[model samples]
Target: MIKEVGIIGLGNVGKVLATFLKANGMLYWAVSRSAADDENILRNISDIKELPSLIIIAVADKYISAVSEKLAHKFGKELEGVFVFHLSGALSRNELILCENNGAIIASAHPFQTFFVTGNYENVFVDVLEGISWGIDCKAEYFPEIEKFINKLLGKAKYLSSETLAKKAIYHASAVAVSNYLTAAITLAKKMANLADIEAEDFLLPIIKTTIKNNFSDVDFPITGPIARCDLAVVKEHLENLSVKPHLQKSYAFFGAALLELIKDEKIMSEEQIKQLEAILLQKHLY
Candidate 1:
């Protein structure tokens, strides 16, 4: 039933939220620290003459607390009945406790999707959010509103208990491993491909896509590679080739060792093979 909304930041997430809210016919206001040519985006929170029922603090994690405090001060007791939420994967509802102390209902709703928009954002359609999951940490009573909000944006809401939200650091770390770390690994592969005088995308894209698709299709065990096959000779040759680039060498060795640990319980490799692969991956010379 909540129709009016406000956004406290105009970063990539904020802009996308604003666009989707407008597209969905929700009455809203948005503000940023700096001035902008967009009339819908106000210069400051104080610029608004009317307050909305819900306010999303879409600023970076570092600024969530400060921004919440500012809101607590700016609206004072008027925030008593308003709902305040932040879009930080690593932070919990505690980040907005100041606003809560001042009587605002607070929660943390993090969309499990990355936003790296540059230049014009007009072309960044809302369909990108379709079917994406949102990690929501809030009181059970407030879930319906949050779920409705996400549904409007074509996303699904996943509720997290207070205990689960408290361990958000680990949860966010998992996200970073799959997204950021995966990107780093791909970059390293591109560099390795360069050494072979081949374009990384042309050589790796198909296999990478297929691998990811297979993994998603069967998450329990979809691993494939020289390590998965327990191909000791191939692993040794890779380490030797990477010896010229110590950084890449270390990265490969570390990940190779991790992958070995992951498949140690599987029947794919014999106990002796596992130990041998581990030794090669963990050898001091590789480091």
Candidate 2:
């Protein structure tokens, strides 16, 4: 029975949501503090006469509570029992209790995907959001409403257990490590490639694709490099070269240690070779 919808932020997620909603022929109203900067925002709350039944506070994690509180204060009496939610991966439903106290049904629906403000969203929802897993924090009773909402964007919702919510920080850290940290790692690799007068796309992208594909097929067997082969000499040479860049040096050693553990567990290297490789990683060598 969800009809009109309201989005309370116009950042990357908000903008993408607004564009998709509009394209899907859904009636939605959007507002943000910096509405002037974004064409997707309709108007601020002060200008809206009637509020929507579904309110999604797609603001940053830190500002979700404040924005929900503001909206609760402004429309608490009018929108009783309306569903209000935020799109923060790390936060729990407790953050929206203020809005719930004001008679709103508060929840969270966080899509486990990255969003960027692209001007065209014609097929972006189908391309990016479809089949994406959503971390939804709410009571069992609210899943129908939340799932229906998620269906609009073609996503699936998994109810986050209390245990998962309790460790939200750790869950979010894993996401950041793969998504944000992966991007940073790629940038660093590209910089190193430039230093060597090489194009990253020409040298790295194919191997990256192969590595990812191999990961999907056999995670335990995907690793292939000096560490996997127990080639201590090659690893030592790499460490020596990496010594010139402190950041790269640390990144390599940190992840290299983790890889060494995996290789040891798989018995890929002899005990002596493993010890040699471990010592090479721990050794101090100046560029």
Most TM-score-accurate candidate: 1
TM for candidate 1 is 0.89
For model 1 the local lDDT of residue 8 reads 85
TM, every model:
0.89, 0.86
Clashing pairs in 2: none
Superposed model 2: Cα runs more than 4 Å off: 37-44, 117-123, 218-221, 243-246, 261-275, 283-287
Candidate models: Cα lDDT each = 0.84, 0.79
lDDT of 1 by residue, 59-103 (tens): 989999998987888888888878898999998899999888888
Deviation in Å, model 1, residue 205 alpha carbon = 1.3
Give the true-structure RMSD of model 2. 2.9
TM-score between model 2 and native: 0.86
Model 1: CA > 4 A from native: 25-27, 34-39, 118-120, 265-268
| Residue 216 in candidate 1, Cα distance off native in Å | 1.8
